[model samples]
Target: MPCDLEMGLDNNEDGNGSPETKKIGGVEEEDGDESVGLSRKMSEASICAAEDDEDEEGRKIELGPQCTLKEQLEKDKDDESLRRWKEQLLGSVDIAAVGETLEPEVKILSLAIRTPGRPDIVLQVPESGNPKGLWFTLKEGSRYSLIFTFQVSNNIVAGLKYANTVWKTGVKVDSSKEMLGTFSPQEEPYTHEMPEDTTPSGIFARGSYSARTKFVDDDDKCYLEINYTFDIRKDWQSS
Candidate 1:
């Protein structure tokens, strides 16, 4: 059975001239046994049983009333996704449940960028905002960090197949990949740094820049893919 997968590009800019940050928050999983190693697929009966148990345990928590309108809207979208996933899983056991999960295996809550000797800066990537694209300015020859904060719903072993940034001209800027080890139902935050010496200066760089990431589960299947774009310029702030 083919894996269930969903892919989308999220890019939003902060009208206030702040750096833009894109957030993809949701659980993604394939049909498999988490305890018996990667290739062993879970039986339909077992999955249905698990679903029943979860349903009996009550629904997942909902967003609080204090959330902003945008937050509420995002929550609504997630809820709709969850509902669709449940329907798909319950409707057919023969089909491999790709994006459908009894519970979210992993969800990316937020992404941020940080510079050396400076506090982490939250990019303003709204659900629906400006379309001029997200912008970020970095000091030439300075190291920068890309941070990803996520939530894991179950214990699972996962790794990044690849995480890289590239220019519109097709030149690769920076990239990294490694096993993430075992994670349980908790928040896991990771930081990847771009070396000051290795990174190209935005002043001389032309065209837009984007970061692409692919995440795989223990089964070595790509469950989630994320792409975000932004412009890098010497005088972007003045424009």
Candidate 2:
């Protein structure tokens, strides 16, 4: 792969009529190119890993100082201008109703499955140790989506995230993570739907898949975790 001979650039001589490397502004030597290339690749990999860790360690990110919404709203009530601005920012959310709790409380009430041109199949979220198991089936190559209805109370939930991992026969097939942004306690539950995806179309891909999903905030406080199983079949499963 060395193109020095092809480009007629094999002249590894110095300016003093002695043997030296071509400087090309002296950024690096010809012999160090391989090392530089390897270092660049390693740096890129490190960046990718750091990005992944960033979601898990989001609470540690500094944003000056942190305070509850109640505290922030009460911080500077004397200044009418500032108070109005804060009111505009918080909107009609009643901070006084969030109570005196110090940490956020989140509840995922339901999970719904939606297929194009079909009614949504709403499923109740099961308890952690419920003796019963939750299951569903999807047709191969059929597009479907998942929706979560959740509520945040007590305080603001920062960097809310949803993570799901799928496995088939004990081997992980896919993993997905998404930041659901921050949420303040409100009277209404929040509904978020993930992008739709098609079931893989193949005999090997059609099988039972177990998935574990978790909802957590920046503090790593898990709001909910669910383990469920589903099947990808050749045809839509009848109710």
Best by lDDT: 2
Model 2 agreement with the true structure over 71-128: per-residue lDDT tens digits? 7666657767656544553455676676356677889888888889888878787677
- Find the 10 residues in a row with the least total lDDT in model 2: 1-10
Global Cα lDDT for candidate 2: 0.57
For candidate 1, write residues 1-239 as lDDT tens digits. 00000011211112332222211122235424132222122222221222122234475322112322122223335455644543332232222332223222665555566666677656543333222445455434344555555555433223322233344556555443423333323334434333222124544554466655555543334545656565554532442
Task: Compute the lDDT of residue 157 as modeled in candidate 2.
Answer: 65
TM-score (all chains, Cα) for each model: 0.44, 0.69
Q: Which regions in candidate 2 have their CA more than 4 angstroms from the true location?
A: 1-66, 76-85, 129-131
